[model samples]
Target chain A: MTRDAALLLPSTEPVTLIDPDGHPVPHVGHDLPDPQALVRAYAALISARRFNDQANALVRQGRLAVYPSSHGQEACQIACVQVLDDGDWLFPTYRDSAAIVARGVDPVQALTLLRGDWHSGYDPHATKVAPQATPLATHLLHAVGVAHAARLRGEPTVVMAVCGDGATSEGDFHEALNFAAVFRTPVVFFIQNNEYAISVPLARQTAAPSLAHKGIGYGVPGERVDGNDVAALLKVLGAAVARARAGEGPQLIEAHTYRVQAHTNADDPGRYRSADEVTPWLARDPIMRLETYLRGRGLLDDQDVRGYAEQAEQAAGRMRAGLGEETSADYRDLFTHVYAEPTPQLREQQALVADELSREEER
Target chain B: MSAEKLTMATALNRAMRDAMHADPTVVVFGEDVGPLGGVFRVTDGLTAEFGEQRCFDTPLAESGILGMAIGMAMNGMRPVVEMQFDAFAYPAFEQLVSHAAKMRNRTRGRVEVPLVIRVPYAGGIGGVEHHCDSSEAYYAHTPGLHVIAPSDPADAYGLLRKAIESADPVVFLEPKKLYFSRSEADLTAPVPPIGRAVVRRPGTDATLIAYGPAVPVALEAAEAAAQEGRSLQVVDLRSIVPFDDETVCAAVRSTGRAVVVAEAAGFASVSSEVVARVTERCFHSLHAPIRRVTGFDIPYPPPKLEHVHLPSVDRILDAVDELQWEYA
Candidate 1:
């Protein structure tokens, strides 16, 4: 049966449980999350923000190659990992380092690809996270496939595929959502529309009403939430995940947010837009907004806020020390995993490299 | 043992059926793969036997099909996906190269994409554009992929079975021209190891090397040469990526002359790689400069002109005659 397009459409206005001033905003369908989960999300946001700052410092210190800072989108990042079970999978893009770390991956291991040591520093299977895909929207299809496979095997595993606003312009995005809806795969495509794909604005990226609205065409219901409001994100994402887990098919969630920082340390945002534009987003800072809500409810006191800050500082220090330890790469690593068993040609090439390295040492 | 005469399509169908019976985790899917069977009927009756859960049809999106296959494979399911045609697989090339080929290596062996991408390729049925591209080189050049092509019915069943059981991703290229080619063989025959070349015919003169659709052309050329009192040997290359260097080099060394043939463009192709490798390994034993008979370095022509563009028996013999026969 064909699904009603109107029924699948997102709310014209982005859903908000808490206003930018950190005051609760009651809505018809959504409600505030449990105070415990809100506190956990707050703590993770602090750590994620701290990690982003430290990753920038590492880049300046010559310890890391580069990092795509999720400086302003912490609510969306934490909510993605927080909603999934340990048995579920997370397919993240390179810009999703914040979520990767929030998923309990070691900060240093999570930065492996950005560090230039390997494509992925940590074992993906151990954490049930895919490697941080550098190509835009390419891993979305993989997420759909995993969800479909889980359904086939009678496993109740849900998958979350996270991509940026720019990724919505990619063809794989359409294909992934269409396949997920057709197969009724238990997956959520979480699109963090932070208003830019590098320098291109959301206005130039699409003519659609919203990224979430793009899902309705594929039979996947769409939802939009206030990205700065942690209470709202937790509520919407949690509900979407539950629907998927209950075999209601895939869901698409577009978090309306902003990228306060430049695309990366190398980018100069000053060239693309004026400081006047960032001033508005700073007022709607996800961390500050969430902190105010927690404080107002007495769920988080000054002591708890200070404790989370200290905990984030400790994590940053540990990551800094770990990354500071310089290590040489093993040449054999290049050929070792190209195949489960190295082919003869690869073996011969490995030997050639080894022979050349020894000759250079002799010289 | 009773030998059953089977077409290459039927053999492939049986291989998939047997694989599905043996492993519950193995699945078959692609466009038109279920209910209607594949366009070539390669997956004929699979959905009926295994049910739609095991055998299914996907949307008409090549990248989606391959991308989903990679994900399924990562999750411990051996997925066999079919690209409706050779050219149709181009849209999925990024997924194949970026994810499927590098999934294991990039993840440092933590993930394995055990998938079989079945692409029916090559021109002999006078197929129009997009249907007759011999795209083996694109896959063969990729580091982590295994490129296999079967020349006959037996190898179609045998090699596809091997590809399904493989621990890594395999690009199984089926020669569209040979789909209905008949051969009598035992279905339970133990197949030769992958990446090993098989000597189809023995001779003392120049060796004719080929794979896929070109293999039959080379054999026909060799027979034509034999009638002219020129004993030309024929060697079928079953695998293109982990090239059978030993078997190929040995044949070139014994014959002291060689000719490579393939349906893809000669420049920077699998045929070019074969010539370069044989020349490097058997330079001392060469009685003549190695030659190659390949499709012209242009887009596959219209159905009427394909006969001229594709490597034919005449083209193979011409390449053989150019192997310094006077010096021999």
Candidate 2:
């Protein structure tokens, strides 16, 4: 049996196309995305960042229960989702609201779970995006399953499952990766290593050289990318998607980034981390770097910048307006949708609840 | 339709084959299910009939198997996944409880997980730990999961087909002990409906409600009870989660006495549920308090002590005798 040479000597450096300063950097064998695509990705990143800010504001206003802001990781979320085809599926995690919004899920619907509502707020079938899983790494196996089934049915479909660095420590993560490799499922796993899994940091999660290296053990090729670099993320994730669609099995793309905000509206980052540790990451801000690159390449001017800003503002306003409407959940919804046909016991329980509700109405 | 004698294993295989032949989306998969025809051989000749794409072996991971089945089901494929053994299903409990059970509801009916998780459960063959476990209680406790267990060949074939055809997720528990038990059945006859019970034997003295592995033991007890001049009615509860309480209550009301039997532990089991339901519905029937003939509240013991641990015909008879005692 011939062993992969790269598996024996894995690359330590991440695949990077541009530096933190937005200057072109040399990388082996990877080309930049076309100017139009880069510009579009940049627009998505800005919009996602604005959406994150609005969602945080809504949480403060008591309109939302919580919001896990994907502030610094906008480039990773936007670029990874931008590479998928209309028919392909995207499986995202709780903190992946930016990715969900980037994939055409309405901002209000994407935050519905965090809003403590019944069911996932949007139809996953309509958007080709699975419900944003709050349980870490669980959706990975679902992604692999869908991709494997698609392959079995001779469908030219690939699945992208996005998870956090902390999620890689979950057992489902290992099972998903191993199953994908063994079954040769057409899946691409994108890990945004954003430093913390709530209060826990990456160091506490794994002792491996990197999360990407974990894929090598599962017979999956691993690639690391600058998560803050939109062009690099698009390039690496796009290639991985292409490889999966071509039936080359699965690959793991570890995007190195950091979480810029607290875990959520309820969390206090100051309790665990100091501001000094966060200062250096501010220089590598994804939106600023992308704007710099676009301005330098003459693709963006003052008018274009103002236009993009107006679009972001309008999107945020739409989210605010959507949240402003009052939507009441039906109490009977709890009994329905649990099964195709509710069991006899369920029917009895539903009647009991209905009676109680009626009694309360009379009262 | 001509009648032929077939074992429960062969009946289940035929059920899978028929379902696969009927629907192009029906896929069967699990560890050892494809090539070895499963360790129980219940899936024998399936992979040979259907190609590997339809019937295949999965990696030896229960969570991955079930998770993939859920995905396939959501994507318009009817997937029937097998858990290699009863206790082996524990690894996939998270997937079943969190995703498989909650998907259709979580998606608000935009997608339905038309998946069937077949598990060979309950002990009588004297297997070691982790091999023989009656874990139906766990799945039954979870909402959105339809838990069904069949005893005879006819119900086995019929229930397996209904489960695969159902739009909801079903935990189809096959009694491992009944796998080799043969019965004469017309293969082409109309199968029974899902989530209903059938009367194996009718009488008036007492009612014996049993399912899966315990059904045969209950029938044997009923025959033994007949010799003692006590006519016992045997009710085979086909499904546990959507239990046929109406049939159970009707039998209990007529007989005025009831005994629930199962190989699973008595605590929080299907037996306890039946006893509770009978007591609630048939209180004025006035014979005696319900007695549960079930396995002891302990782990499945070693083979040597399995007979003592499991509810036998004599134990069921003893419970039936207790049903004659007057209660306050």
Whole-model alpha-carbon lDDT for candidate 2: 0.89
lDDT of 2 by residue, B110-172 (tens): 778899999999998989999999998999999889999999898899899999999999999
Question: Which candidate has the highest TM-score of all?
Answer: 1
Off by over 4 Å in 2: A1-10, B325-328
Per-residue lDDT tens digits of candidate 2, residues A236-318? 89988998998888999999999989999889899999999888999999888888888999988999888888999999999
In candidate 1, stretches whose alpha carbon ends up further than 4 angstroms from where it belongs are: none
**Deviation from native of the Cα of residue A199 in model 1, angstroms:** 0.8
Q: Model 2 Cα displacement at B198 (Å)?
A: 1.3
Q: What is the TM-score of each candidate's chain B when compared with the real chain B?
A: 0.99, 0.98
Residue-level lDDT tens digits of model 1 in A250-300: 999999999999998889998889999999999998888889988998989
Worst 10-residue stretch by lDDT in candidate 2 chain B? B319-328
Candidate 2 local lDDT, residue A291: 86
Error of 2 at A158 (Å): 1.0
Worst 10 residues of 2 chain A by lDDT: A1-10
